[model samples]
Target: MRPKQLNFPLNPDYGTGATIRRVSLRAQSHRVDAHLLDNFHEMRCSIVHDCSIVTAITGESVRIPTTACPAAVHQLQSLVGLPISTPIRDFYAGGIARHHCTHLLDLAVMAIGHAPRPSTEILYEAEVPDELELPVPMTIWRNGRLVCRWLVRQGAILEPLELRGRPLGTGFAAWASLVFEQDQLEAATILARTWLIAIGRRYRPSQAAGRPARDNPEMLGRCYAYSTGPVETAVMTGEKEAHLHRLQREA
Candidate 1:
């Protein structure tokens, strides 16, 4: 499917030999609009918050892997009455993530978290290399400035001795939180989320098109598409799940 046009400009060189993800956030006095684009998904979220509470929220899945994924956009309404005062990382811990699209929820929290900040807008770019085994750099950028870059291999940081051997998967944000604050904290969060999605680049979408999440043992009870009971049978395509299953069965 063709990607939707974004309101902001992107770095033309950002996509070279890498999977690039961009999150554009713009804010008014009481509303924040967020748009996300990457190789496998494109989504948008708008959060209307008063000084300290979210009064309204909406989300749209512009491009996604599965038909069921779009329904997660509606789950964003659940955040309508949530407090904006909650920390961005803590928002997901409140038990709202299990029934929502991870990316959409991420956008929602970002929009709400930054609503009170003085900046009118922010742009974040993350580039994860196609080849992780080589010494190529993985990077995260904020606005137009480079935030962090590292040589990564097998999900561990190889360069940047301070972060060497650090796992990029689970517990990354927690470790980053302890080491960063304010602007650094925000950058680390975006980088962590981007790394999660960038792995989708390893698989093509056609391998599992129109498959139900319930059929995949790895996906049961994971996210909105995989929610149990009535929704478990929803046609939810999963790229990583497809790849893993293929490797297991084909091997």
Candidate 2:
């Protein structure tokens, strides 16, 4: 068997969540796919396509038939006028109608989340270092075109160094999660820790209320650096579970 694809989950520690999901879409296409697998529950499906559900067929544990309440999560048609990049905040503001289709909303969000990540130049520029000598950009590639890059200090405190040219996007962890269908429902236990290290905790350690990430190494070799990691990395795992459950309930 092939190695399991890496996906970051939003919550773990329960039979409800612990799933691995993947999302795929063609460029500039309306069609999208979401595939979800609950590893701990030993429930899995693949190569099953529902035009209604391009990715994984979700809510197996929830076990409500799609036909039972068609209106509950069928608001996707109203989303046509909206841009694919519509932020989740804006989507939430749209309000859920009693007949609104929650699965469609979830899948649509997953579709938009797969958006392309920004180049290293973009992330570097976003940091906007203080007056300094001309900075250089270093490029590394994987599989011929995948430039391998990461953020690290130049052996100094809070100093950001230049690295890769391609990343999924701002809040990439979230977007990548949607794109990859690795939300907390999939692979919860491992993904929780995986995200902690890969997303933020590994880079921005010891974050506290209001203190933020003041201990990370900076490009200046003196001051603390701005953190690019996701907020999920800072909070305890239980916090994420609570947050996700609230969102699910609201949906």
Candidate 3:
């Protein structure tokens, strides 16, 4: 059974480019003991105690499972170099969910299931590219005759790009307000929600009917969820008696 409640906030930008994922679960005799190896450029997968193992051939990205079907072993190594941004859920829905080496895929799913909340990563920062070119002036006409000419996006009248400095990526409302030159009590909601999705699978992982999270509110910027349950001692403490007792009680 899955945890009754999961809290995953966006991991800070530690600036570590290496893609990494980790997960651990415990309940009574139920346990998931697994490991996934992803080195941005290659992947290796293994699971112990269940008698499955995937090991990369020396000096090659190919992984051959020792106890699985040879064909399945051949496919295990194919996961190498998958984009770090690849959606593990989508990978499942795309027919990999029940592959020959299911433990490998399950490990990926478990990592994703324990991942940080998508909503918390909404804040983004952008820098002015060194190649940013000033827009050329464009002529505009009122009624029929030309009334005035102004730099593109009104660059001549607009604040200098550098003068504007780099604003914090947070405060979408403030950004919208600045762009519109007015309070954005309405557009702020739309912008923030749109941003969360543009950054997460919550939107456009597929079509409207295919998204996994259909329960999200129509207006997500203002919505939240909280759930809890009876407690149990943390596993891995070597307290086997307490572990089984609490799991039985929870069950």
Candidate 4:
């Protein structure tokens, strides 16, 4: 039997507070487990790998935006036996992305890369306030240290002259690759993703369960459930778990 979906709130009120997203990755011997938690979703993924190839993969959507979202977990099986030596994005370039859940795929890939390391755990925390009218600081912390801080207004970066005028979406990963060192690049990538995701806080999608994916033009074709084309019919699950205060409490 599939595991039961679990729900618990890190914050009682969803859209009224800061939005926090946390990622945790742990490695031991041949296995690695990764988890992602935010206001809208909670997902877990794990991989068992040999020194060079992945042997097993598992993913679970603990909390999600739509009913059809859970079906994407089965797609993780297709990634078993995949070679870990190559860049993962190369596979996404080949159209493998539209077949799986985006967050789960990212966690599984992170696990594969982490399997060869000594037993360790890495944590990433991101915070984006609900206020976006004037410039606001968006930040990311890696392993408990503040690693990224960018002033954002609307959806574009306004402070840090080098990053000024860059929108938080599309080309962000590519542009960040050219700007940061390896470690900083990874943190910036998380920050960029969370910033865009935080937008949901203002719209409060959790209350609109059962709404069709195709109705949201901006999210269409972005991931598996949304890419189902004209027949796309995934709806919100109406179950939201927020940790919007977790980061602040830890501070």
CA RMSD for every model? 9.9, 17.3, 22.9, 6.1
Best by TM-score: 4
The weakest ten consecutive residues by lDDT in model 3 span 239-248
lDDT of each residue in 188-246, candidate 3, tens digit only = 22222222222221112122222222133232221111101101111111111100110
Q: Write the per-residue lDDT of candidate 2 for residues 1-251, one digit (tens) a residue.
A: 11122123322222222122222232223343432222111111111222332333232222221122222222345554455455555554523422333333444454444433221110000111111233322222211232222232221112123312313222333443453433232222122222222222111111122322222223111101112222212222211111111111110
Residue 172 lDDT in model 1? 78
TM-score of each: 0.81, 0.28, 0.21, 0.85
Measured by TM-score, how close is model 4 to the native structure? Answer: 0.85
Candidate 2, residue 84: Cα displacement in angstroms equals 2.3
Q: What RMSD does model 3 have?
A: 22.9
lDDT per residue (tens digit) for residues 108-171 in model 4? 8777767767899989998888763467788888887889889998677988888899877766
The positional error of residue 111 in candidate 1, measured at the CA in angstroms, is 0.4
Across 113-220, the per-residue lDDT of candidate 1 in tens digits comes to 788887588888777776533665777777767888888776678888998887777677667778778677777767766666665555444456566645555555
lDDT of each candidate versus the true structure: 0.70, 0.27, 0.25, 0.74
Candidate 1, lDDT over the whole model: 0.70
